[model samples]
Target: MATIKDVARAAGVSTATVSRVLNDHPSVTAESRERVLAAVERLAYHPNAAARTLRSADVTTLGLVIGDVLNPFFTELARAVEDEARAHGYYVITGNADEDPRRQDEYLDILLEQRVAGLLLCPTDRVSPLVEEVVRRGRPIVLIDRSIDGLDLPVVRSDNATATRELVDHLVALGHRRIAIISGPTSLVTGRERLAAFRAALAAHGLEVADRDVRIGDFQTASGVAAMGELMERPDPPTAVFAADNLMALGALRWVRDRGLRPGSDIGLASFDDLPWFEFVDPPITAVRQQTEEMGRAAVRELIALLNGRPARSRTLPCQLVIRGSCGERQGAQ
Candidate 1:
């Protein structure tokens, strides 16, 4: 069988450059790419997908690494990225980081070893090393959802603080003075900013933020369940709770059900990231909607531009707060 080395020799280019040309990578120059493709055709060479994917893998693909895929926010983001990538003649390989830095590092290393055309990451704070490694290896990367501090990579994100603050204002207007917050891991920029906004919202209203009113955990349903449990255990628990992510919201709902407590009526709930089942529940939970699909599309567009030798701004898309029954506030009832 004809191999990448054979193609490289025929094209008089490095194996890596030949691989890039084969994948139709946007980063490769037209003249050099043409030579490689011509050599590939002349040699009648075909890539062994499994082996090629490791070092000589020259496929048109984007590598996406996220903190949590099970979370609706990330899942939706992945879908958006995939859709946009395919439109540009590229496929995506996704991996979950589980909000752990070590896992993030491992995935990035693996992706680079595969010679991916580009990569997108939702990094933990521990992401700096990985970011540096990608840069060192000359990989084009776009950070998504969370920016890796101290790195100069292109970033695509939603305005987390603004959305959370708006949600708090809406809750306060509903005559709920005690609004508790359940947030995700603080290592990521989004989680930290959103949590800060929750506190700032309380401060903005001249309301005291009790330490007990906050719970920190991974954005998993189990964490939300645990946080809600802690909140309910308090002598003077909050009347309204804000679960920061869809998975946490689900957890909060489950705990609300487990304790036989009414969600919308007994303890008002507002969540971020609306899911399909939101309306089907007894009372639909309100949410701060992040434009995951649009965000993904925009990110891919920027990445493609970067690949094509165009400059791209680090983007932060806006969020829309979707009001529903869970916040104990009827819409348009001013």
Candidate 2:
């Protein structure tokens, strides 16, 4: 609770002299500097971070707002971002939008008010006016995992098309002609691109996804469970199911278990994201793993570049397909 005045009184120097010593001004005598340092240590006096940040145009704090908290993918991403920011001598404040656009905007506003040096976010909506305004004002922002349509913001995202194709082709080669997909919302770029990739891959293999075979999920577990239920209740359920994200994939697995059906045997299941636990599950899952940690670190690099008045470019990290028993023995890429 010690203030600048307390430090000044303890140091037997003027507040201006303490300020000069704290700022490392060359004019301060060695004797004054030692006194200020001793006082600071004795009182455990901490400078006002907000005031210090405002004193200079440089920002020592960064902000991260993720689209979902329940998804372990985003949680890992947040951790990676925080670690990277800390390494760069910056502190990070994270917010979970929980897939709500309104909440996403609110978090954005809060960060802006805090005067964060830069922002890294996985946007929940197609377009946010607050984000657009921030961009127009030339504030540094890096988009991660997802992006809006027209915004020209720097981004770090997975190349889902190639990976989705690999997964679908692997399933096709396994003799799964009728493939069902649990897709995320079409409103988001990741959702649209992934679904498009699935369809495109199937078409290339002389197959098609029927309207009934495609179930729309909100990128949440409950929606995944519901979608799986609907697909399973069909007169002719698919032989293979692909969930676009890990949580949905887990939801699909739960539905399969509830029916006493085993994946890789009764029905094939594949997913877009992979976790350590995925390999140890009842049937090790087949998945497309994105460079999640790399994506977070890259986003920080891009934002820092922008903060330094350098041009920030978009990044597309590749995803690798990891095949296992859950998808019924992935046949080599067709």
Candidate 3:
């Protein structure tokens, strides 16, 4: 059977545009409407009856999809999003993507099927075709934490480049010439930005980033453990190592402890994410602190603006570099 998607493709317009033309929405341009009608007639396209019925139902909810629920950063951000949503007279339904693109797509599908008003997504490394369709449909979607290339969606995230440079400078200032980094997939914006910044920072100090100094991680504890193991076993290992996130930092810490290596004296350690537990460890971890609450609130506000037919702008909040004992210093010395 001819479907709405087919009509949209044939007309060279978004499915949302086709819907607007069919429903006589005043915002649609006459040229778009004419094209859509011509394509519909040629294709004999019919919108799904069930989907139309579902979309007609009143929607007072928003969908929030996070990268991973186990990550404390995401857990805190979700709470802040929910709080802000309630204040705006809207309820939020959250889905944990668990760092999987397929799971993220499934959540997005379920949310759209339920006719949620809008979505806040912490995107995976790659964008899905369904997400492209959603964008073309003119649905309100605010990206939180991560972004995909070629998408003009509003985004709320940290200033990763500046924060990473600061972290690297600290490591260099501590007389650590040979430094290494455990980073997430380069396909992610955060991963790419941090890795680039690390290289730039090293270059600024008249140092080169050797290929062996960079280890690809999955932003998970297991990857961190493996990367740390590999780094420590090298013929000439790095004197300092930076993990891109808290979970990975924890993994690195575990590996260091299991091998009877002290963090500050034996080798330095740092992380991109700051957690409450960092302070309680034997040697506290130095980290970059992203404003998760502010990010969440900003994402909700931007999404709400879109819902109200107002223009929404992307925002990058500043990050704080918290120096602690793990990075070759006493907790309060720096």
Candidate 4:
């Protein structure tokens, strides 16, 4: 088998240059990198990743633990992280927390056991002992999409409070005062901030939220469906309903259909996270479109910065309000 030295000789470059090319060092010239790659291919030179990692005592992999892989938002986030990490010559190991704190802890332990160079997590809980331990050990960590308070770590997420305000403002502009909401779990920052923003927006409009008009969901479809059912069954149902997440919005839609109520006519509907399918639905959903891919990319960048002994900062990106017929802003059929 050809060694790094053989590849270096074939490419007419120093062994260090060949090594730099293999590791995707940014300083290497494009021509040099191409020549090294061609020589590697010709010589069939394959570096032993395990031996290299062991010899260097450094991990070239990043662990990304998402809140829920089943959620398309998280899935897309993972894809973006993987794409960015690969571009930087790093690999990603992803785990799904399934929105369970215990499961999230388990995944954290598993990732740590693998000795990843860094961690990216959409935390299920605001505080975790395992995460604390990891931080105490001086491991690089960057929170994505969700965060825990009291933990000094870099984070990448959307500005939920602002987005919620925008959604509520849109509903109020459409003359909706008695609006109901399906909120996510209070334990999660995303859920709590959104619910608080909704209330604040209503207060700004001189409207108060009634207890009967609010239902706390688990950021899941079933919870949304159940919450919608409870709201619509009330003696005085709300004219507009907002779901904190996309899955819950879909669930609310199911409840509306089951009750023979047409969205955008009988009742206005809005959601937090927008998806491609939202546009193709019967009544296109008005939603808060977060920069999910950018969130992922930012998380990886921050983590890389931390790993490189640089200052990593927390960032919150703005979300766009996508107007559609579901919010009763436009007249439409079905």
Q: What TM-score do all the candidates reach, one by one?
A: 0.83, 0.96, 0.83, 0.85
What residue pairs clash in candidate 3, if any at all?
A: none
> Per-residue lDDT tens digits of candidate 2, residues 60-174?
8899999898899999999899898899998999999999999999999999999998999998889889999998998889999998899988899999999999999889888
Off by over 4 Å in 4: 1-55, 331-334
lDDT of 3 at 277: 87
A best-first ranking of the candidates according to their TM-score comes to 2, 4, 1, 3
Candidate 2 vs candidate 3, TM-score winner: 2
Which residues of candidate 2, in runs, are more than 4 Å off? 330-334
TM-score of structure candidate 2:
0.96
Residue by residue across 27-120, what tens digits does model 3's lDDT show? 9988999999999999888777567867686467999999999999999999999999999999999998898888999999998987789999
**Candidate 3 TM-score versus the reference:** 0.83
Error at 82, model 2, angstroms: 1.7
- How many residue pairs of model 3 clash at the backbone? 0
Q: How many residue pairs clash in each candidate?
A: 1, 0, 0, 0
Which candidate wins on TM-score?
Answer: 2
Candidate 4, clashing residue pairs? none
Q: Which candidate model has the greater TM-score, 1 or 2?
A: 2
